[model samples]
Each structure stands twice: as C-alpha cells, then as structure tokens.
Target: MTATVTEQVFRLPDLGEGLTEAEILQWRVNVGDFVTVDQVVVEVETAKAAVDVPIPMAGKVVRLYGEPGTSVAVGAPLIAVAVPDERYREEERAGSGNVLVGYGTGGGGGRSRRRARVRQRQDEQPAASGPGKAASSSKSDPLLGPVSALEGGVSGAVVPSVSTSRLAGTPQAGEAAKPAETAGGKASGPGRKTAAKRMGEVPRVISPLVRRLAEEHGVDLTLVTPTGPRGVVLRRDVEAAIAASRNAETAQPEVAPAAAAPSHESAEAERVPLVGVRRAIAEKLSRSRREIPDATTWVDVDATALVELKESINRACPDARIGMLALLARICVVGLRRFPELNAYVDVERQEIVRLPHINLGFAAQTDRGLVVPVVHDAHRLTLAELAARLRELTADARDGKLTPQQLTGGTFTLNNYGVFGVDGSTPIINHPEAAMLGVGRIADRPWGYEGEVRLRKVTQLSFTFDHRVCDGGVAGGFLRFVADCVERPEVLITHL
Candidate 1:
C-alpha cells in the first residue's frame, strides 16, 4: 500500500516592535529532518535584535524557503514540512494545540500532495539525494511532495513557482539515452548540462523573489541551465552560479587594493547596508529631530562627593563595585519625582501632556551592534544598590545583544552616559515621545573653590535636553539644579525617598 503524505507551509511571523521583515541568520533544520513543535528552526535578525523562530508543528521538513543572509518578509512562506497521512491523522485526533504570537494552531488538516511525473524512455532512475529522498519516496514517485518541484532538488533555495510538469524532457524509458556532447567530447547527462545553462535564464524563473535575487546578484538567468520543470531556472541555480563566480574570483591571485596608499582616487570607501536595527535607529532619530521642539540646559557639577561616596561604598562592599552612572541614574529618578513633566510624552494628536505615574528609566549603552537604550522598569521603586545591580546587568545584556523588546522600550525618561566615550558634554536630542534626556560627561579633576581655598575636584558636565512645550526654562532649570545638587551633596537624594 502506498502511504499517504501531507505538507504544511510555515510563514515567517512578525517579530515584535512592528518589524516588517527579518534576515535569516541561520537555519537549524534541513530537508528530510524531523522537527517537533516549538523547536527553534531559524535564527533571524530583525530591525531590533537577533531572535530565534520556532516551528509550530511536528513534521519532516520537505523544503527550506530562504538562504542565510536573505531577507524574508513577515507572513511570507518560510518552510514546507511533510508527514505521513497516519501521523497527520493522529495529530488531528490528539490535537497538539500549540500556538505562537500572531499565529495559532487550529484543527490540523492536510493539503493536497503533488503528483509524480515520470520521464519518458529513461534508461535508469536518477540517484535519490537531498530533497528527493523522503520516507514515502519511491522510484515511481521519486518526487515525494511539492518541494522537489519548488527547490529543484537543491538545498536551501526556493523555486516554488516552477511546475513539476515543465522540467526539460526526462530520458525515455527503455531507450538508450544520449549524453550531450561537450567541447572535450566527454559525455554529460542532459540534466547536468541543463543545469549549467539554467543559471543565466531570467525569464525562465517564474518566482518574483527568484527574479529579484538574480537581479541583485547580477546573475544572467538566461545563461542558467534550468533543472526545474519546463526548463525553469530554480533559485538554487542562481545562487549556485553566484557561488561559482565567487569561487573563481578567490581562486585567482589577489591584487593589492590601491586604497592602502590613501591616494585621493583610491581612498577606501565601504558601504554598509542600512537595514535592520541600524535603519530603525536612523529613522527613529530622524523622527525625533523632526517632531520634537527640543531645548538644552547644562551645568558643570562638582562630582567629588559622589565619587567619594562610590569609593566608600566599594571599600565597604568590595564585592559590589558600584558604578558612578548607577548613582547618577538614581539621582535622575529623584529629579524626575521633583519635576514629573520631564518624565512624560507630549500627545500631539490628543493635545495633552501625558505624565506617567511610574518611571521606566532608560540608560544609553553602546554595543558592537550599535547604540541601544535598555530600560529598567519601576526604577523609582528600587533602592540605589538594586538600581546599580540591575543597570549593570542590563548594560551587559545590551552590549551582548541579548536584550528583549520589552527591556529596550517603554521608557519614561532617558539617562545618557556619554562620559564613557571620554567626551566633556553634548546637547543630545531627546529620546522621542519622552520629554527629556540627561547626558553625563566625563569626570575629571578641575580647579574648584573648596572652603574658600583653591583645590582640585572631580567635576563633570551634565547636559539636559527637554521638550520646550512640556515646561519653560524655570522647570527645566529646576530639574537640572536638583540633579546637580544631588551629585554634589549625595545626601539630598535621601529626602526624595
């Protein structure tokens, strides 16, 4: 008895933060591999961060839709999985009700299985390999499901637009097949020769995605030898061509780039793709500048006391090395309490200033990926030490690219520690929607008047940018003054608690 087979198509879902697309960083499974529900199948880098996507069902994967480094839009088909009819029936009866965000598992049902197409007058069957081999794969129906037609037996490439009926004429059965003649008089099978020419044929590719990829890579599809039905060039064929072209380039000896000499003509220019998180940042910053009528107020603070307090605490608890930024952040929370207008967003549509009850303090952290602000929720409620520990952990996580969407947003106010970059001060733009941002400059020994005597003190510049519409100079100055006083005195912060 021929066992029945069923296939399911899994589409990429929206990764949070209103992301429209994500680039496939890596795939965890390949064709013919069995996968369980909720198993992480692919790692994708979105506009915010890298995240893993889980498969929603248990089945044997028949085809993977995208290659690594390729961008796939949300709701686009990602992979196709096939399973036996009985297994599918069992899944339906038992109903493994697993669900994912934006996608849900309802009643399980099977889709129509693609039929087999036999080549006429073929002398022998092509060896089963890669995508062609399946649990129910057979000589008569060597093509197990839609994947063989879609991927054209190539791994990691999508070629779903091609129909199985259209692949170039397969060898007739019981008739001696003639191998295509090469320039060297060596005989090659029609399939292999067909693939060689399929890489250059653009019109033969029916998938819009495949065409776009061909255009991007500058692959002449007309020269591509089609391996799919009706002489259609598969996506894999285009990628293979690209890979071969790259290999040929690497095989040749490299010529030194003239950029090394730093000549005006040869000055090295590199173009980085402004996509994903970087693009999102650019758009957000641009929007902030475009929308917010922001103003700046700064003060040079005597941080000597704050520094000494941190040193004393560290000496007392050597295991917990308290960071200066943590102390400064605690002061910011206190300052926000005194001036709540700074911890709010202006609602232009509603014509209102929405003041938040709780403070979700965001701190600027620079990472290899880029600059990101990780938020500490309910920061106002935490003790100074607790705030310090959480800030340290969150900063480390941000630098390591492990922060989640929740940890990166919902901030009521921002504290920027530009001091780490060895800068003295900067009038930074406010983080959008939020009314203000506090920028801390580098701490350094500067001449100061201590007890009417000339002395050197640890001093730093504190730059504060606030939305002018939120409050006038008086409120902004008062907020900055309160923060500077806390930094200088350290004891004044106790009153806020």
Candidate 2:
C-alpha cells in the first residue's frame, strides 16, 4: 500500500476567557517551512495580550488558511502540516500525539492500546435489512430513508427534492417548499427543496454565547461532547469541562487546597464563558486572593510641596509631561525600600514570605473592559524622567489593550491612583499575593496644621492596605507614614535615592 500523508491542521490554542478569535499578528514559519514541536509558528493578538502560538507537532507547513492581520475563529484551521515520516501517519491512526483528545503519548512509541467497544443499538441494525433494502427504503420513505442518509453521510445527497411549483401551488405547503438550488441545478429528493429553503432556518447547534465562551477558554467545541437538547453544545457543558480541568490540575502535589481552585468564575453564573484577558485576569486574581491575607490603613497627607515639585520638574524638562501620579509612584518605591517587608508576597503553600530585592510597581489603570494593573519593572532604579516615560508607555498600552503577560506579572506592590477620578479617598482592594496596595486620592484645598498653625493647604488622603497576617498594624502604619513623609517633603524622596 502507498504511504499515506495524514494532513494535520493546527487550531488556535486557548488564550484564556472566551477569546474565541484572534488577529494573526505574524506567521513565523511560512508555507513549506519545516518546524519542530513547540516551535513558535505564529504570533496572535487577542483583546488581552499578544501571544506566540507554538506548533503542536513537528512537520512541514503546507498552507496557511488565514493571512496575517485577519481575525480567525477559535478551532478554525490555522496552518496545515504534512509529516514526511511514514511512522508518524501510523502513529496518528493508532492515536499517538492525540493531545487534543486528552490522551497524550508516553515516550515509548507503539500503537496506542485500543479502547473497549461499547455496544450501541444503532450499530447493530436489523439483520433482515441489507444494503439494497436499506437503499430502497431510503429512497421511498421521505422521513426514514433520507433522514438516515443526512445523518450518516457528510454530504446531503440523501435528501430528496420536490417540485417548487407543487409546493407554491398550495399556499401554505408551497411557502414551506421554497426554491433551492443543488449542485446539479435541479432540486431532487424529499425535503431537498424544503431542507434547502430551511437550511437557513435550521437552528444551529452552537449558540453565539457558546461560541464566545468557547473562544475565551480556548476550548475546541468540536472536541467537547455536547449534553444539550438535540445534541447541541450548551454553555454549561463548556463550563463543566473547564471546571473538570481545574479540578485535575489542583489534584497535583505540594499545592494547597485553597490554591487548587484555579482562577475562574463561580460555576453558578447563568453564562460564564472564559474569554481573552478577562479569563486570565480572573485566574490570576483568584489565585492571589486565595493565597494571601490583606490589611489596609489610611493616612492624610499635605501634598502642596509635591504639586509644586511637579511644576518645577515640568519646567526643567520641557518635553516631559510629568504628572502627580508618576511622582507619587516614585515616592512609593522609596517607601517600599525603607519597609522591605511590604515589598514582598506571602507564599502560603510554602509558608514563606518572599522578599523581592527589586521593586516592580504595578499601577492600576481603568480600561473599558475592567481594571488592569500593568507593571514597571525595576522601578527603584529608574530616574524620574525614565519613570515618567515608562509609565506613559504602559498606560497608553494598557488603555489600547496591547499589554503582554510579562508587563502585567511580577508586581511586588501596587498603586491605584483613584485620585484621577476626582474622589477624595476610598480603601482600594489589595492586588493580592503582594502583601499590600496604596490608594491615592485627588489633591484639594483643605485646612491643615503646619507648624502648629491651621492654614489652607493642598491635601490628599492615602489608604494603604496590607496583609495583616504577614505584617501587624505597627509595620503597616510605619510603611504608610514613610510614604506620606516622602510625598510631603518632595525633596526627601530625592535624598533617599
């Protein structure tokens, strides 16, 4: 027998949340290029992040179904591959490399053990019925014969067509039997014309919501066996599959029971479809919340000096658009240095507090979708100008939804500038795993004691929430005081550096 070349198509992997589709950013390997397993084959941009998609199997790329910049649906063919090895085809038929099916190969390559067959009533047809009888039966009975053909065959050839004139002549039946063109022009077969007219009328098995959820979770709905009415894939079925995946992951060793609940929405929502960045953000935030204990404290500060300092800096660097928020972030880094305990996270599973030497500050920005905390790595080392430039770049990218996973991870502490919203002050939730969060309020003219004299001054409130389990009130209070002092004496921040 001639060696068969099994065509393999790689679909987009789950980018988290129901991010059903992605814009192909670039094709790393063009048609005919040989690629190895796990090689970066394409770059795709979802709403949440730009991700590099890897090749699942080593093969020669035969064709690309979609071009760069085009949005392709999840599970749609991305690239076709042809493996030269004959053994690869045999292995595939024997179910090797069927990772998508949840059965992965274990090093030694032999034919996969066959599964025990489950007897089905349909598989055992009436012994009295032969192929000829079945074919004749299918031709005569419009419902029984043709319907069997429609179910068994990929092509709809088994459907029979009736004359549209006969259908149209009967006001109701004619309306039902609309004109439908077949490959042969003439519509023949029972319900052929009706089926064609109703093809658009047929209720699709997958709903828009189901599709959206599947896309977010990077789930191949085709692989998800449906449990809905009429074999339609339901949203709940997809969610259950996701939950089962999480449960399996949690069962792994050395992980806390609480941490086992991999980040996802409550299984109770009417429609919780994992999609895009939202799904990823949910998982990370969930993990943080479960793994950390947080505490918060507030301090009112006179920001008159910092406001003046910003004006002075703006004058010195004409091109730099320095803002109070960036100045506040700089002070936070200086404060975190003095109180290093606040610049660490509690690894509950390991029962250890990780004290990071570098200060990677995460700034919370409000996006149209939700809150995203994009980080500035090594914030302590950067000068004011460098910090301002990096902050500007991060904020711009966060708003435009261009942030990568790297830019969002590894934050030792976070600052939520609620001040921009013109609010006086409110306690901000801790961006968990990190022990604390600082909320900055808007500066407004208020009466304050300066050198024992009550006078009008530009004042702002700062709410610092820390993980009390890790650090008590004294440590948390001291950290807040240090940050407030830095903001009050803007020059002190420069001295601390």
Candidate 3:
C-alpha cells in the first residue's frame, strides 16, 4: 500500500523566560531516523539552562537546519519530519497542546518552507531522507552537517581574549559560515549568488550588526549579495563589500582619510565570537548597567559575634554546619523583612515598585562555567539549618552544571559573597530586575574599638547596591544598618527569627 506522504517542520521553541534563542548542543536523531511522539531529538543550551527538546509527533527526520553549536532563533525551522499523510493531516486538525511561549498551536506552518540542499563534492554520499542514506555529500560528516569555515583555520584575528570576534567582517569563533564549493572543490567565492537566486526571493537575512555595517559602509545588502551558509549575510560578507568599495575609491582618491583610521585599528585586534554562556552573561550584565540606576553603600562591621555564633552552631550540630554565607543569607532575609522595599523590583513599564511577597534568595557562586547565581526559593520559610543545607546543595549543583532554569531564576534578592575571593569590597552592580544585592567582603582580623579599648576583632566590609528607583538612600541605609546589627550582635537575628 502506498502511504500518504506529508512534511512537518519543527521549529525551535522558547526554552526559558526571556530567551530569544538556544545553542544546539547535540542532536540525538539523524536525518532518515524514525522518531516517535515525545522522543527527545535535540539538546539545546539556553541562556540560563540546558534543555532537551522532544519531537511532538511521530515522523521520519528529513532534514536538519543549521549545525551543532549554531544558535537558532525561537521560531526558526529546526528539523523537518515526514509522516504518513493521514497522520500529519490529523495532527494539523488536532494540534498538540505542547506549545511554547511566543509560539502558537500551528507552529507557524504557514512559514514552513525548505531550501534546496547544498550540492556536495566528490567522495561525499548523495543526499537521502530516510535511514540508509546520508544527509549531505560534503566533506563534513553528514549528520553533523558542514563545519563552519571559521573552524578550519580562522583564528579570529579580530578578538583575542574570547574565541570569537564581534568586529564587522570577522567570523565568530566556531560559527563562521560554511562556504559552498564549486565542481572542482573550490569555494564558489563572494560573487556567486546561486543560493540566493535559487530561492527565487531575497533570503531571510538576520543579524542587526550586518545591516548596521552595510549602512555605515554605504553598501546595499541586495547589491552585495550573500555567500554565507544558507545565503545569510555575515559580517565578513559586509566587510568584503566595504573593502571592494575602498579599492574602487582608490581610483577617485577623493574620500576622507578619517574613514581609513578604523581599518588600521581593526587590523591590530583579535576577534572572538561571544557565544554560549559568555554571550548571555555579557548581554544580561550590559542590560543591567543600562537600565538599573544603582547606588552602593558600604560599611565595616565587627563580624566577631557572627563568626562565634557560626562556630558554636557548628560545634553543637556538626552534621549541619552553617557557613558564613548561610549566616549572612539568614541575616539578609531578616533585613529584607524590616526593609521590604529593598527586596522589591522597579516596574518601569508600569511605573511602579513591585513588593514581592516571597524571597527567593540568589547567592553568587563562582563555578568553572563562569559566574552563576543559584537561588534558594522561599528562603524566608526555610530554617537557618535548612538554608545552609540548600545553599551548599545549590552551590555544588552550579559547579557541576546541573542547575535547572528554575534554580537560577525568580530571585527577589541576591547575596554576593565575594569574601571567599579574599577581596575587601566591591561596588556591586545590581542584578537587573532585582532591586538590591548585598556584597560580603573577606573577614580579617583588624584592630577595632571595643569596650572603650582597641582590640583585635574579626571585621568585614559589606557593600549593598540598591536600585535607586525602588527607594531613597534612607531605606538603603536602614537595610544595611540592620544587616550590620545582625553581624555585630547575632542575638538580634534570634529575636527576629
């Protein structure tokens, strides 16, 4: 019996709050592989979490868009699945309810379109859709797709510190476009516009920076054309256009010398692609600096009492030893109760300060995978002992890269214990969307005035950064003072708890 044939395009879905796209970490299924409903097809890394995506229906994988390590937008086509015609039609009628935020039930089937597979070179297998056939005939592994040219020998002379450069016309580390090859196994070169012309339309070009570069260089994108993977215009493509223009300008010799200054500087720099977690952190931290009007206030506190309290607790209950961070976090929860405004967020869109009822406290933890803040939810409800246990657990999880999206977000307040790093003080930038962050510096023995005499006491510097829009300095001072009081006299926290 001839089965009815239908194509289903699966697009990348929103993996977490505020996530625009995700890096394709790995693909569990290959083209021509038969996958059943709810079978995990790919694992993606979002900004705050790593998520596994499962296909919503049964089908045979036909094509995979983009390669592993490439970032795919939320609504971009991920994979195409071919199913029995009757099943696909039924699925269209009775669409699955497993929809993602910012996406609809139909999954944008109206935009479901596919491009012709790139022609491969000799020694590569022919493209086939089902099991027994290869996905591409390129030198690259058919399943992994073609490796970006940037990975071959491009060192990103544009950015040195990180792997990828963000400069115009430079390939991001590991994510440069895979150039199409000619019949003789040579790059088709920039002038070739076969991929764009074959689509019978202007290719859907993304990348705001590419457009901006084109504008700055006075080059029309359509006129320049595309040679990047899937006919997308890349930074290098725009740069090439500008270079071509400059070569043309030599004949005229009338252009300003100022235009050449930037090129000289660019030649000296190394470029790296801001990808993966590094890219996310850069974007979030930049947003925090731009949006949050923050103010920092610091004080030196005698942490002798707090330190003694911790020792006593650890001695009495060795099983659940409370660390300094746990104690400070406990003190922070108490301080927030007295200064609730500091625990709130500014809703600029609504022009209001939101007072959160629960305190999901996030503590800064430095891990191998950059800096992360693993949160303890409903921290106000947890006992001091429970708080210590959960803090340790989350800290370990963060280091192990096992934290979930929920564990990393929804924090009403943050505790940054840079003290572990042996630093004295830091003017903390407020974690955006949250009103305040408490920074704890290293505890050291310093001469202090105690009982009308100078004596050696354990002292630490505490810096508190608050969103100025949430409250004035008066509230900020009050919160910091309350926390200092708890550190000076651990007995005070006992009364509040």
Best by lDDT: 1
lDDT tens digits by residue: candidate 2, 98-189: 23222222212222111100011122234344322322222222211121222221100000132212211211321222233455655454
Q: What's the count of clashing pairs in each model shown?
A: 28, 26, 16
Model 2 stretches with alpha carbons more than 4 Å out:
1-47, 50-78, 81-275, 278-290
Highest TM-score: give the candidate number: 1
> lDDT per model, in order?
0.72, 0.64, 0.71
As a whole number from 0 to 100, the lDDT of residue 376 in candidate 3 is: 96
lDDT score for residue 478 of model 3: 94
The alpha-carbon lDDT assigned to residue 111 of candidate 2 equals 24
Sorted on lDDT, highest at the top, how do the candidates line up?
1, 3, 2
Tell me how far the alpha carbon of residue 336 in candidate 3 is from the true structure, in angstroms, after superposition: 1.1
Across residues 273-391, which tens digit of lDDT does each residue of candidate 3 receive? 45557777888789899999899999999999999999999999999979998999999999999999988988889899899999999999888778888889999999989999999
TM-score of 1: 0.72
**Tens-place lDDT digits, model 1, residues 71-171:** 67777778777766676566656654444346543323355324222232121234232222333334333325333333333123333454322233333
Error of 3 at 352 (Å): 1.6
